[model samples]
Target chain A: MLRIFIAITDNEPGVLDRLASTFRRRGFNIHSLTVSPTLDPAVSRFTLVTDLDDKAARAAKSFLERLVNIHSVADVTGTTPLLRDTVLLRVAATGATQAGLFQIANLFQAEVLDVGADSMVLAGSGSPERIEAFMTALRPYGLLEMGRTGAVAMQRCAAAASLETAVSF
Target chain B: MERPPQPPESASASASARAELPGAQIIWRCLEREGVDVVFGYPGGTILPTYDAMVDAKVRHVLARHEQGATHMADGYARASGRTGVVIATSGPGATNLVTGLATAMMDSVPLVAITGQVPSPLLGTDAFQEVDVTGVTIPITKHNYLVRDPRDIAPALREAFALARSGRPGPVLVDITKDAQTRAAVFDWEAAAPRRHLRHVPPPVPDDLLAKAAAMIQGSRRPLILAGHGITLSGAHRALAAFAEKAGIPVAATLLGLDAFPPGHPLFLGFMGMHGSPWTNLAIQEADLLIALGMRFDDRVTGDPATFAPHARKIHVEIDATEVGKNIPVDLALLGDLKDVLDRLEPRTPSLDTGAWLKDLDGMKALFDAPTWPRVRKGEGMSPVDVLKELQAQAPGAVMVSDVGQHQMWEAQVMRHQRPRTLITSGGLGTMGFALPAAIGAKIACPDAEVWAVAGDGGIQMNSQELMTLTQEGLKIGIAVLNNFNLGMVRQWQTHFYGDRRSASTLTISPDFPMLARAYGLRGALARTPGEAAAAIREARAADASTLIEFQVDPEASVYPLIPPGARIQDMIHEPPSQEAPC
Candidate 1:
């Protein structure tokens, strides 16, 4: 079973390698990993998904936590956390399938970002489950190219958000 | 300014005024401040700056024939004197060569500081000559490591490296500095930059409640066994361990590296406990109900299969490193602190236990399943490895024995009698070959007043035989014993027991005249075919002021018995073929 682990670490040379190598060395196969700068400029955040067993997962967590530069590691797996993956798909857009493609995109709440003579580029971002279904729906449209941002996640917060505070694309 | 009529510029003032010195000089200054009087290393391209700086430093450097030997020598020095060993080498191959030594030190928790000079910062990742990611290479093998890009960071990094190395749960640490960093000048302030006060590792105080819990466990134990390890020696807690054992009337068994931490002939001493440990020691551990594991990680060799290791024991793991408390074996109580401090606190509060029946049972087991013994041999019969080790120990009673891995290592552990702590230095973890000869040189250098012996198997001695030149160059009076069985005896033994006795490639056909080989290094070498000859050869080496190598042509068929087959339980040990009374 896949599990998601989040780590906050110092943005230093070889720190990423140290994190990735910890998983590799422990034989923990990472399925998806997304890394980016956190709000704290000095620290970077990593969201990793692996299929390690319970024992191996605990060992890996402890092992990664022991790295000198790592600040904290949290296993957000099965925590009902908010997990997202973004995908940009460039697919053929002809008269026969254009309507059906647009219908599928609408159903998944995907946006048609670019439209050309015979092709259209669609952008979608949502939970990993929604993204997987969206990708499958777009696969039959003679897909030419695609790019995906690996799963990034965070624990659900209880704070309420106003219209001005919430931003959506 | 003239109000004080200051005493004519003291050395401290002079040091502050003369702050501008090469980075390499700072390295030496830091090492000197850390009380490193001797260093074992070999110089190369990237490390030339440090070697050049050594001219002004007061520290003595022993030039090893190989980098690996240098690391092992430093390790041996640490194990012998309880001081952190220092080794210096260059980048690329020079740095990589120290990997085995670093790993060996890592496995055995030896306090070692390895300094490697890297290619200039500009050429770091450009694949320049003698450029390698020394820090990256040594990350897993070292307790901590630093890659010095700026010259100013040298002193602090070195200081930190030494502190981390010699601190809690001591292990090897590496400091890799760029050649430019070492060659460039940096402002060195001894007091302000190198804060010696902040570097000490003050072990955390043991909690009273935890000690009470541990005490109660000991009080409840009827068959208590103390599994002492290197931590006892590292903490200088041998006396405390012995006192506690006596107070509680618990029998103590030392781990492979822990062999010398307790007196050899004490009634409570049950001998070394592990794979090739005495049959009685293994049985005692298996039968004991309470195991007080001190400073040992319960390595696979000791535990065999974690599931079945000491199946009846309720463990109290007293370790300095918290990560190791329950990493291998479950514990009923964990008293995490410095072994000496913990044992000291426990000793006074602990009441004498009535373990008379347990002790009697252990004594019975000891006599029933004693260490393997060989029949009295006539001349022309090759010497047994145990006999060779016993003869060597008999001759050099106070000598520190540094043994390489394999059959001879086990024999030395089982047969040699140790009266002091830090006396038996070997690669217990990792089990690296070629460790003995170089480590002996280091141990001898550390304690020049004491004799040092390098006990190695024929296959193992050849792994670092080139270090004989280093021994000769240093003019160390170390005795080297090569237990030659004309084969890799341990592997051959495995084949004999598990693989239908097909001795595939384990047998050595091409051979060297070991004594003649020693003579090539300008040292005396001798060959001993019998036990009497082995004794005389050792005596000859002891008499000589220079180093000597005595190659004992040992019995090829002889093997270490009471073996724990790989993946087998500790209780399921295979006894010797000739003495198969009960296979218990």
Candidate 2:
């Protein structure tokens, strides 16, 4: 199985909805998915995960590499230096559910930004894995709204060199 | 024809000073000095002047359809006669076309001199015309290359190129002459260029102690194997190897490129070893206690899993290239020098020991693997490549047999026998297809009295097979046979084993009926469907004494027997169970 980041058209209101529908139609199961807007006004990033085996993973990569409206797709399952994402969730004021959600948020180092008469909103920024795990823990609570940002990765300091440092082809 | 006038003395000092010794005039002088009796080439923009020159020189020029064909022809000729084979091509695309041929020669160490015309020097880097950096492109593939910077350099460069190509570890060399240089008058001074500046050799013997140690290892080892590669061919050490192996009672395995090292019918021969090699050979390799490899790189294809390859044996490697010594597999002992020189020194002091027990063990392995009598070879509807070579072998006996890359070549090497050095030519290292046909033409040109045959597979046959036209026009009497399986059998075999029986793209583009194509090129043709018919066609082709193409269409999916698939230890070979083992 491989984890990949995808760049796709972010303008359409239901782009993520359509993508998930396609996955279900192909009997494909995605382990994780997060979407977010970028500095580019017209595009969005999608960090996705799949449970495919090696051969199937290679075949799937080849297929996705040829899709239209796709800016790029990069697999960063291992050796990716740096990555971060953000998630914000609002939940109703329920006793046991609220207490459990607060404990999970505390575990992930999330900050409780607001407490309203009927709900509370929690915000956190960390790795996509951390964000997704937190979201799964909070799903049972009567969640009012939830939003998560896609993972954006950057090269780590000093170790981020490329082949150009060697020979000039 | 009146001889062209000599260049003025002033032009000698000025060097690049242009004069009017028409390109034709220069060609005549050049061919005369090089003793060039035959050339394989096609006419093009930059070579027009030189072709005109051939008319006046009375030299034979065979017009090949492709530049690659010309290069292979030259390679074949050199292998045939031990003389430098010379090929010609025009500039730009013509020069680029010879890349594969040059690489093929480089890998096998064939002696070839390729002369290519260049655009005028003024337009070289301007993108003015059909201009490629021929020198740069061929740098990795040639023993040496020269771009004539001045008209005066032509004679010396030509002499040097030819000399370098045939000396030491022979290889392809290129002499790129600018259009202006070919046109400009240069003093005709063949005598001025000496071979001293061109000779390549290593003086003196290797340390005597090295041979003594190797001798000790040979005597003590309970089981020993001799692995000889093309280095034996390059060093002209087949006789020494035979002497050494026979005296020591060592079973020998020839890498695909090392095909003719031991006479195929020798009692101690184990045939080819490595990926796609014989099960018997692989099993013997796995079981050997000690191994001495001569002039062969243990590539991944040859040593499926290097760590486990012949795991039971300690290795001793004798090779010319230092980088290859331990690149793939490590060696317990190393001797670097000319193989012939090293072997000759070892012959006298070699200790006599009967590895009877070792031989018995190897025989046991041979029996366990080489016993496959299936795919019953009969005079059915297809030609037997082995029989075709056999018939041709009977006629020529020692007429150098050269093969292009593919399964047919492996079959020919396994079945045919060569009694002399430089008699069996092949592109061993590069394994380039489309080598044999032109090479045979070159061979015939170099050794006119010797019979030459190009044994090729179907896919390889058509790569540069268009040279049949050249054969027809020159009326060169060479034997030609194609093992047409309608597919690239070697890779297809790999696909079967590694890719789960997925034939994939190994199938051919279907072929033009070989007989019609041969006749179209003004040559007699025949087809062999069975072993008997194959032999008969070969006899008939030799009798006709003209260019011929005999096609042998066999079962497309017939797996070459005795294969040791990649990544599998040789000991895991799937050999036939008894009832079919033949004595080596």
Candidate 3:
């Protein structure tokens, strides 16, 4: 099963390397990872997607929390969190398929980022499942290139106080 | 990056007004504040500034022949004294040499702080002369690490490194400071650089309900066994372990690293448990109704095949590291806290249970399956390793015995009895060879009044034997025992048993005369060919004022018995051959 983990860590020089190395050293395969600054400048937030069973996911959470710079780790899998993934797709499109591609993009609420003679670039952001469906819908148009920003997550409700207090420590 | 402003009232006026010192001086000041009286290290170009400041520093420095030896010395010091050991080295190869030692400490959870000097800040990523990313290389091995480019970060980094090294599940931590950082002068305030109070993870109080549940299980168990581990020694929970065991009449089995945690001669003590453990102990584990694992992870060596390990037992795991709870074997209950604290709380709630029948059954198995009687002695044969170890144990029962990895190590664990904690120090987790010589030096330095001995196999002793000069120079009166079996005895034994008797390259056909090697290092040396000779050599070495080495030419074909083949169930142990020949 795929698991999602959100980790808050101190913004130190090698925090990213440490986190990534922790996964590698423990033989945990990370499917995707995205790291960015949190609201607090001194801390960074990491969203990691890995394939793990329930027990292993818990073990991974415990391991991550053991790192000195890591403030908190939450396994948000199956928690109905606001998970989002962004993707930029460059599809091969001539004059004949431009209108159809735009119509399909409109249905998924994707934005057209660039238009060229032989290809058009579209940007989309949504749940991971929705993004997968969007990519499948545009597959017939010949995807010239694609870039994904993995996944980022947050609790649906206003439970920011827990993370805020954890990071301040 | 600009330096952050220090809190105004963080330090007293006197502390704040102290003269500014170079970052190198700040390092020593921090060590002094941390109550470190000695450090094991070697000097190099990158770390020259720190070495120069040692003239004014109060800390005594012991120059090591190699960086790797220094780290092991520090590790041994920590294990023997229950204090955080410190090691310092230069960059590049010097830093890399500490890798094995760091990994060894990490595996066994020894408390160590390693300080390494890196290339100047600007030359860090440029791969300047003798430059390497020490922190990056050590990230996976260290509990925590720092790369300080600013002079002001030195004190805080050292303080935090020391704190983290000794806190929670203790392990080695590293601090890699750039040469410029060490050379630059900075204002040093001990109070201002104090580690944050919240940095330490305070384990939550053991849940009362869980404690009650564990107690109920203990009270209900008829065949309960306690698996004591190194954590008992680390947390000073030996008394608690004894109390808990005696209260319920439980038999205790210890892991290899946990040999000394429980007194060996105690009636309730079942000899060491694991691959090479006594057959009775392993069989009891297999037959137990309940297993209370205290302060010990269920290493694979202990549980040969997890699927068939303790097939009938319900296990309760008490560990300080949460990751170790279910990492190896699933447990019925996991109480996360220091072993001493958990044992203290659980003891009060525990109900005394009758285990008389179980104890009697285990004793029968022990008498039947323990060390078998050897055949009649042959006239011209060499000494057996077990006999040598037994003689040493009889002669110096209280001396700290540090054994190197291999056959002699297992034999030492088997024959020598330990009565107190911190008496038997060996490389258990990492199984690193050549750990005994230097680690014994460290142990002796930490406990100057105590007798220390390093026991190693012929192959293992040669790995770090150069440290004998360090012993002679430092005037440390330590005994060195070499079980010279003329081969890597453990590997040869495995070949004899598992690999169809293909001797391969395990034989040490060409090796140094260890006694002569010691003599060359300005120490007394002797060679013993028979059991009586071995005893006399040990006696003479013990009485000598200077360091001494005794090489016992042991039986090359003799193997450690009651061995569990890799991945084999505990019941399938290969015992000693019937009517084994005894040495002269």
Best by DockQ: 3
Instruction: Give me the displacement of residue B476 in model 1, in angstroms.
Output: 1.4
Query: Which segments of candidate 1 are over 4 A away from where they belong?
Result: A37-40, A76-84, A90-92, A95-111, A116-119, A133-146, A153-169, B1-19, B190-206, B349-351, B370-380, B578-584
Candidate achieving the largest lDDT: 3
Q: What is the DockQ of candidate 2?
A: 0.01
If scored against the real structure, what TM-score would every candidate get? Answer: 0.89, 0.69, 0.96
Worst 10 residues of 2 chain B by lDDT: B575-584
How high is the CA lDDT of each candidate model? 0.84, 0.72, 0.89
Q: Quick one: ranking by DockQ, best first?
A: 3, 1, 2
Per-residue alpha-carbon lDDT of candidate 1 for residues B139-251, written as tens digits (9 for 90 to 100): 88887788887766788778878877887788999999989889877667666554342122334788999999999988888999999998999889999999999988989
Model 3 TM-score (2 dp): 0.96
Model 2, stretches more than 4 Å misplaced? A1-169, B1-36, B56-59, B188-204, B370-399, B574-584
- Candidate 1 has an lDDT of 0.84
lDDT of 3 by residue, B155-262 (tens): 988998988898889999999998888988777877767786335354787899999999999988999999999999999999999998888889999999889999
The sequence of per-residue lDDT tens digits that candidate 1 reaches over residues A1-169 is: 8889888776767787788888877677889889887766667788998998876777778777656566667887867778999999999988788899899989999999988889999999999899889988888888899898889888876522221122110
Question: Which candidate order results from sorting by TM-score in descending order?
Answer: 3, 1, 2
lDDT of 2 by residue, A23-70 (tens): 564577877676666556456666677777654554445334322223
Q: Decide which is better by lDDT, 2 or 3.
A: 3
**At residue B255, what lDDT does model 2 achieve?**
83
Cα RMSD for predicted model 3:
2.5
Residue B488 miss distance in model 1 (angstroms):
1.5
* Backbone steric clashes in candidate 1, count: 0
